[model samples]
Target: MNLIDTKNQLTEKKKHVEKVANVENATFMNIQLHAGEEVAEHDANKEVFIIVRKGKVRFIVEGEPVDVTPDNVLHMVPTERHSLHAIEESDILVIQVKP
Candidate 1:
């Protein structure tokens, strides 16, 4: 069992990635982005779930653009390509389930 205070991990960097949890079956991460910062398109090698924790973000998934706000949750398969752009300062949790 683990208890983490994700907000305390925030950083002033344009892009910050923090490992929140990891076990044999899954990995969890906290991603913080300042306005104008982005995570370039990439493929997730494992099934992935993205949870928007604060502010707003523009998500480009396989060439399609979708706006996301707090409480929005997105699911993607291993082969999916995606990217995220912060419309405002944002925080997101990324969970990847291994096969």
Candidate 2:
């Protein structure tokens, strides 16, 4: 089994959001976002599953914003226009299934 501690990656970035693929040959990734930061406006390349771990997140889906907090799982369909904001120093895991 392949395991990773999401917060312990040595390459973790200090600014903005950062992502790293942890599973071997699997279309999954672990993403981290800094507090008060925003991933403004982007089109999804695939169906993405977002899991919030530490803080809160707000997602803008098709112009409507939804609040996502810790322990929340969010899904976005392929090619959907969306954006995300970190409410309070969030840690999110994004799995891209159809990229």
- Report lDDT (CA) for all predictions: 0.87, 0.73
Give, for candidate 1, the lowest lDDT window spanning 10 residues: 5-14
As a whole number from 0 to 100, the lDDT of residue 49 in candidate 1 is 85
- Model 1 residue 18 distance off true place after TM-score fit, in angstroms: 1.2
Query: How well does model 2 score by local distance difference test?
Result: 0.73
**lDDT by residue for model 1 (1-99), tens:** 579878734454458898989999999999998889999889978999888889799989999998878767888899899988999988888999999
Question: Estimated TM-score per prediction?
Answer: 0.90, 0.78
What TM-score quantifies how close candidate 1 is to the native fold? 0.90
> Per-residue lDDT of 1-99 in model 2, one digit per residue for the tens?
656566633245653344565444336665566777788799767788888877888999999998887666888888889988888777777787764
Clashing pairs for model 1 are none
> Which candidate comes out best when scored by TM-score?
1
Error of 2 at 50 (Å): 0.6
